[model samples]
Target: MIIIQLNQRQQKIIEIVKENQPITSENIASMLNVTRATLRSDLAILTMTGILDARPKVGYFYTGVNQINLLGNDIKEKKVEDMMGMPVVVKKDVSLYDVIVEMFLSDVGSIFIIDDQENLCGVVSRKDLLKATIGGLDINKMPIGMIMTRTPNVVTVKREDSIVLAARKIIEHEIDSIPVVDMDDEHNVTKVIGRISKTNITKLFLEIAGE
Candidate 1:
């Protein structure tokens, strides 16, 4: 059982809402001597945590004490596809210099490497590029494939997988992002459809927390 500790403000908000059942955000704001906008974030967090439930044209009501447990289960059940973003990809034969430019232009920490058939082949991260450049390799002549972490080594997740599994892979591999791949009949990677990064996971959590 996981216990989510509430902040002082959140605790206070819960107290106020419990004391005044079905209270409006505006009224709660007045009681706290703060504007409704100011309390919006706190309200969101409370609602997301299940500590407070909002009704249309009504007000907020206390749900129950086990809200955090329910929220935790909800997060665990969320699919990776729901949170994946479009991948930043590069051709295997593209020059390292071009790869660098694309990476910077896309503002991504890593890039997926693909073959002419668009099959997932490899992945290149910022560290991989930095190491290659620092080794005095001719960036203009070296193809990105030469420096990429190739297939059979690349960690990948599928669309149907859970976001929790994606997060675990990210942490265990110590990588900034993982490619979300589509599979062929033989279970080989067929295409790079999307990517899951630490930022994506963080944003998902914040979005759920009503941030």
Candidate 2:
């Protein structure tokens, strides 16, 4: 393996390249108020370090480094269910205090609230609990179902949808997560099986970005 050691200047060059990737060395030099030759030398050092790839006519760009496991590049073909976390759920009758305890134990940002029929009823987030607590509402006395968002106008995706497509829903909706619902033979939502969160997309992106 060729290890390219970067000096302070070379590191700065890499940062510049990252900011204006596929940008010419001349443009970088102009931005940094340095000679093109100096920038070129820095770029060369970074390229040697495996942090960048220089094309003949194109320019310098950062390569995806520190890739995740073998699944990184394959996410486009992967489904959300494959990467989803185990279903962590709460019932409407459960006390808010119980839900809080579960949230802490699971170390998750939100909890899936289900109804008596085991269908998705609502969602409760850390913020929701905090808002209630701050307002002097008793956690132990409050039922999660009473405070939870009812039927939340949930956004969901089919189990067969690709991770890339699922990611777009997150970005476009500006939502933190989407419930993964199972459709019955008649094409109606039967129940929520999993959740896809921003954190999930971030992990996938970091994986594919190799860092």
Per TM-score, the best of the predicted structures is 1
| Tens digits of per-residue lDDT for model 1, 44-97 | 988976779999889999887675356456778889898899999989999999
Candidate 2 lDDT over 77-165, as tens digits, reads 88987777655788888999999999999888878888787878788888888898888888898899888877745567777787777
lDDT, candidate 2, at 211: 90
* Local distance difference test values of all predictions, in order: 0.90, 0.77
Q: How do all models score by TM-score? A: 0.67, 0.59
Q: Model 2's lDDT to the true fold? A: 0.77
RMSD of 1: 9.9
Candidate 2 Cα outliers beyond 4 Å, as residue runs: 1-75, 185-189
Candidate 2 residue-wise lDDT at 206: 83
What's the number of clashes in each of the models?
Answer: 0, 3
RMSD of each: 9.9, 8.6
lDDT score of residue 29 within candidate 1: 88
**Model 2 TM-score relative to the real fold:** 0.59
Candidate 1's C-alpha runs over 4 A off are: 1-71, 187-189
